[model samples]
Target: MTDIDHELEVKAVAALSDGPFKCGTVAIVGRPNVGKSTLLNHILGMKLAITSRKAQTTRHRLLGIHTTDDTQYLFVDTPGFQQKHLNALNKGLNKTVTQVLTEVDVVLFVIEPMKLGDADRKVLQLLSDKTPTILVVNKLDLMGDKGNILPLIQDFDLEFPFSEIVPVSAKKSLNLDELLKSIRTYLPEQEAIYSEDELTDKNERFLAAELVREKIFRLLGDEIPYSVAVEVEKFEVVGKLRRIFCAIIVDKDSQKPMLIGKNGEKLKQISTEARQDMEKLFGGKVYLETWVKVKGGWADDARALKSLGY
Candidate 1:
């Protein structure tokens, strides 16, 4: 090849290699049971956050990182914004939602299709007009006619001047690629904050605790799950094996029998299911031990909440 042609080829290669990379935090905010955690799990292709049918199942702000070829999407799944029953616990959760909104580069305001209620509107008011917010209409599978979404999209547009509106069914994994593409346009050009292999910022102990809590939310009665909290007191690793000890904290002594059940069957089921999930997530044998403890008013007490890692 001629010297001039060789020099041109080298410049072209350098330009392609040094293309701009986009990386920034994206907050997923919505009311309870609108499928925020499900979207995060589907987008990352792993269960980084716990989910259930019950409201207020997600309490913490979890950072789920997704890295593409040239972009690193750090998705923060915040707790559902609570309007009623504002106790100390729910107040803390609401604060988490608002705090996440202010910090993120893009906000995905997820809602159910054709059902924007007072609760959804309350959460919408928390969003900033300045931020590049996307109206993510989740649960499209629930809609009988797909054509109905256009009017719903128009209704949401009146509520906020969204940068983009993408309809998707997170549970069905529909139109997620389009949602990702829409979000990519708003992300700032920067280097990745976390490695590509890293899926979440939470440690194994925190994930272990969340898995146990998920079992409680799924298996137990509605009231019991709301009043319960799981804590991983001890987590020891021994060469592809995890030995975990967890304490299930209840608000009152009367609630203990409901959790332990006759012949300890209820607690046993919770432990078994939690162990199975931990094994799947950690890719190791998990020896889990659980016990019920009564900690009265722990949910409402700020000191107790702080101690419990709330």
Candidate 2:
């Protein structure tokens, strides 16, 4: 991995014989738009979690594994605990957030620096008392006065009994080594559950769909993103190239034309961008096809949500 920290590589490599191999799952969670996915992607040195500027862009919990010579970290990037819309989709996403809380060895309670409000508090309340948690104060690079970080930490410390508090900037890769070291300290000594080379638990098909959804979130306006979901219809590989067909699911028929755009240009851009991302992630060529389909009120329908693997 190009983004691998040299210091971490040295420490991990040096510990191969003297140290016990460490491994465990970490839940990276926070309120909507708090940079949880960005942090996870940086930790893994790859973009396993799709990120967007929009709130609630991440709608699922995906595992990203980072293996070193002496430690293996399995990180779960969960959807932000949604609160505004109490629809089936939001409920399902919230369920996903709460469910993973009980399953991790440690929790990284991510928050934007100097901006812990009601949403952040609600998410923090869900952190189990039994699980060791680290208050990850992210976006440190954005702050003008770096010296004030300690006092900010002290302020947050009074709010919860955190095992540790780390300030980092996931965007600039600032203090990431410190964050990784903090994570290593909490992981238990055990054998690696996954192969050393494995990156994530999600299959290619699942990730392909997410890639499309990510493009929709990245390229489209605010209103259409929440109303969209992606489904990979067919994934066929012949020799070295992948031939993939996908369906873009929308909550209403009116959104379809907008998504497709005049002369199908918008749809083509989405497909091309998503396919390029898939190729990079998969390390192979991809032939992609996309079409938008109206699935009316799927966000509020439990049955439809379940079928779509919500």
Candidates' TM-scores?
0.93, 0.93
Q: lDDT of candidate 1?
A: 0.89
Off by over 4 Å in 2: 1-17, 223-225
Residue 197 lDDT (model 1): 73
- In the range 202-290, model 1's lDDT, one tens digit per residue, is 99999999999999888884757477898889999998899999999999899998889899999999999999999999998999999
Candidate with best lDDT: 1
Per-residue accuracy of model 2 over 95-118 as CA lDDT, tens digit each: 999999999999999999886799
Which RMSD values do the candidates have, in order? Answer: 5.8, 4.6
